[model samples]
Target: MNMHKLVKVLAPAGIAATVVTSAHVASGDDGINTVEAAESTSSNYKYQGDTGYGDGNFLLNEALIKTLEEDGDLAFNGHTIEASEDDYETRADKKSEFVEEHDQKFTLRDGTATKVVFPIQDETLSIDDVTEAYGDDFETTESKNGKYETYVYKLGDKKDDDKKNIIAFKVEDGYVTQGTIGYSKSY
Candidate 1:
């Protein structure tokens, strides 16, 4: 049996990134077999689940990209890939932007969603309804002018010690004007 590992390091905008790949080869009575595993620890964030919009919930990661491309509810506005030194890295890494029929916007990095914004033109979500769904485990911030308030809910259990998942809603006059869901490092 033989094992090989490959590591790639990259830094963009002062952030250190690392990608690790491991391969194992074995030859015996069963002839030869190879297994490979790859992990990118560049970002401390990991996809947990949907955005908690009930039936409208959209999960992040590559599956989201594939779903949007296939789902008839969304319009394919196009996407852009980031250029890197390695061809594999360049092909694997990309930032995709998508818009729903109601004008909701989503921005994904490397197939993982980094941000989602719901426009005011869409059907307004009630703050009371959101509270009823997610409970009271959240933080609130109000604008100085008292015109807007933002409620942020930290999603995920204690098992997710390193990663942080959050869903936020911006409300005005008791109606949610916008919403955002994101995954990132805890620290």
Candidate 2:
């Protein structure tokens, strides 16, 4: 090929690369666009991990949102499906995933047995904070076996009460840690 032809062929490639680069810059892949969009929006509030992948400042295939809403699971973190009444949110996750929203309608009560599970945190939680969440009457129990300590609570009063709540707290090294808080059919 002649030198002139070779130069012409490379010219188009150069222009294409510049165009792509400029497009990314204009769309805020750099710091400028992020600042612009965030300032114009909700005062740039920060979440734990907001990656700006869900921005709507530019035109996009918005039909993708509906498709994702109907079909997507919470495979990725922070992804959740809002409930119809907005009372709760469903977070589909793995075994070890930390879920933020779950509509646990059932409460623990008396003459009932409930199994509870929670992750142990650095600090120990007192029974007062735990008791506030459970409106029912309950008693903290210690087992003779070298096992977990339990707090038994009642959901309601009277023999006609159909539901009961029991909470067993898992303790480690003389400290109350984490445990499951759930309602059970068997007492």
- Candidate 2 structure quality by residue, lDDT tens digits, 1-187: 2212322443565543222211111223453322111112111111112212222111111111222222212111223222121111111121222343221122212311122233434244444544544433655655577565666544323243223222344444544455443333322
Q: What local distance difference test score does each model get?
A: 0.41, 0.30
Top model by lDDT, which number?
1
TM-scores for the candidates: 0.42, 0.29
How accurate locally is residue 119 in candidate 1, as Cα lDDT from 0 to 100? Answer: 42
Off by over 4 Å in 1: 1-102, 120-124, 159-162, 183-187
Model 2 stretches astray by more than 4 angstroms: 1-116, 132-136, 156-161, 171-175, 184-187
Model 1, residue pairs in steric clash: none
Q: Taking the candidates one at a time, how many backbone clashes does each contain?
A: 0, 14
| Number of the top TM-score candidate | 1
